[model samples]
Target: MTGLSPDARAWLEQHGFIPTDDAVWLEALTHGSFNGSGPADAADYQRLEFLGDRVLGLSVAAWLFRAGDAPEGKLSQRLNALVSGTTCARIARSIGLPEHIRLGKQARDDGGADSDKILGDVMEALIGACFIEHGFDTAQGLIYRLWAKELEGDVGKAKHPKSALQEWAAGNRRAPPVYTVTDRSGPDHAARFTVEVSVRNVGNAEATASSKGEAERLAAKAFLERFG
Candidate 1:
């Protein structure tokens, strides 16, 4: 079976993704929308996404567990942060994966290649493909190589902005913070959301991000910076 398209192979090869099973790797990069689909088929990356999600979680979890003698809660936090779709998408971008996704004309036109969901899922699918064609050790090695920076960064010590905001609200004897999505715009794949966060009489602040959750987090962070 023919492997990755020439350009895709070159791009992936640049990122150390040489493939033994070209067909599966090709399928791994094929989006559900590749053929203007209703749902993903075996040819698409959905199933691979599922498998890869699990693989990524396991790899990250194991790595964290081994790297730290931190408590379970701390290990869990690192695992969650490292395996998040946002993190996956960030890693995809760092590796220039957006252009490598095989998409249908409509999806491509709609900016699906840059969508967080698409990029994250494709990253996971790539992991799944590597794991299936090679083995767990190989997949784990790839993950370690890709996630080295995040694993070494200050992610563990940095409290999530939203959680910190909630704690601040309670500590200040204010009502729980409220987040309202003020606006949503752009295509389905790459939409943006603007959120406003308020803490009763304390103060309010607003921010925007690619996803609603991220928007809310930014809004909370803004509120904290402005009022807390």
Candidate 2:
């Protein structure tokens, strides 16, 4: 079997993760859909995904342990958000990891390469590969490198906006913010909502999105950015 390409090796090196077994790295990049037409022994990323999930959790837990004076509950909540499927998918996209996956013809035809589930699984597989190749410290370092920006942002946005805004208003001896639906339209498959958020003593901001939840989040973010 051919060893890992120089470009792949360089990519790992640049990320400070070195793989001792290039085969494992290759396997981690392989999707099950690809094995049928090519190499019979080529394993998929499933097993690696399992291992990577644990590795990611442990690394994030260790980071929270060292970096915070917050209570366990708060840390756990933030950790949950950070490790969510959406967050994982976002991180996967940020690293351009989806571009390196080897998928089968069927998978390629179906656009599985860009599927969030596949990308998330591949991310875990990469973590698993890193752990097996470079050990804990290297894997932890790599996770932190990939997710540090997300982690930092999460810390600031940790409090669910409505609650945070309430606390801010109460602390300042002002009234709480109110959310009003300004516009609601769109088809059943893809509805849109627009919400206006006004603080009792502060100003007002509007956010529009595909879902009420998203619209609320955007409105809250806007309110915080404008007033808080």
Candidate 3:
């Protein structure tokens, strides 16, 4: 049970991915919570998550470069939108990553499997494993395939949800959006933040992410979805 489940294997197969090191992939799907009482050496996804972040960045950058002749600023915006924790969590949820995630009892009880922070981190860690065990080409292939729809058209058209949320509040004559950090977890190198965004007399929403800023943005997006 410490390894991949049958559903995970089938999911990988459906995506045409055959991992060379099951251990690495398993580690990629693990959360630090899973190691709370285990051996000190028990590996989790943190290190892999670090590497995967860079890999995904590089892959997306390259795609942006070849995709069009937009200026660096436009490409940067598109890149940020594409690789944001929001996008990662969406992809993770789409690929059924939550069910495969390994978490401690407390984390599982806290809904860590479906958490944006955990899902996004594990998604990057999986990419890192792919890059290490296979190569950049393999990782790029995976990225390209999964992100085709996002890469299809003008990805630069979307406004950042934070700005949009604030604008919505102003337009509706509600109080400005207020963000509050509800919780933080993980080590200093990779902190996970949970933020709540509220607009008085309007609505409130919460989200979790790798950084406070990202968490705030996600919370804003959730708020928009609920009552923008």
RMSD values for the candidates in order, in angstroms, are 2.5, 6.6, 5.1
**Estimated TM-score per prediction?**
0.91, 0.66, 0.74
- Candidate 1 residue lDDT tens string, 1-228: 345667887877777666877878888898866756423443888888999999999998888878869898788777878887789999999999988888888888888888888898899999999899888888998999999999998755578889899999888899999999999998776788999998888879999877898889889888888898
**Model 2 TM-score?**
0.66
Question: After best superposition, candidate 2 residue 44: deviation in angstroms?
Answer: 0.8
lDDT of 3 by residue, 73-134 (tens): 77888999888787898888987888888788777876778777788888899889989988
* lDDT comparing candidate 1 with the true structure: 0.85
Better of 2 and 3 by TM-score: 3
Ranking by TM-score: 1, 3, 2
Query: Model 2: how far is 226 from its true place, Å?
Result: 20
Best by TM-score: 1
For candidate 1, what is the TM-score?
Answer: 0.91
List residue ranges in candidate 2 displaced over 4 A.
Answer: 159-228
lDDT of 2: 0.78
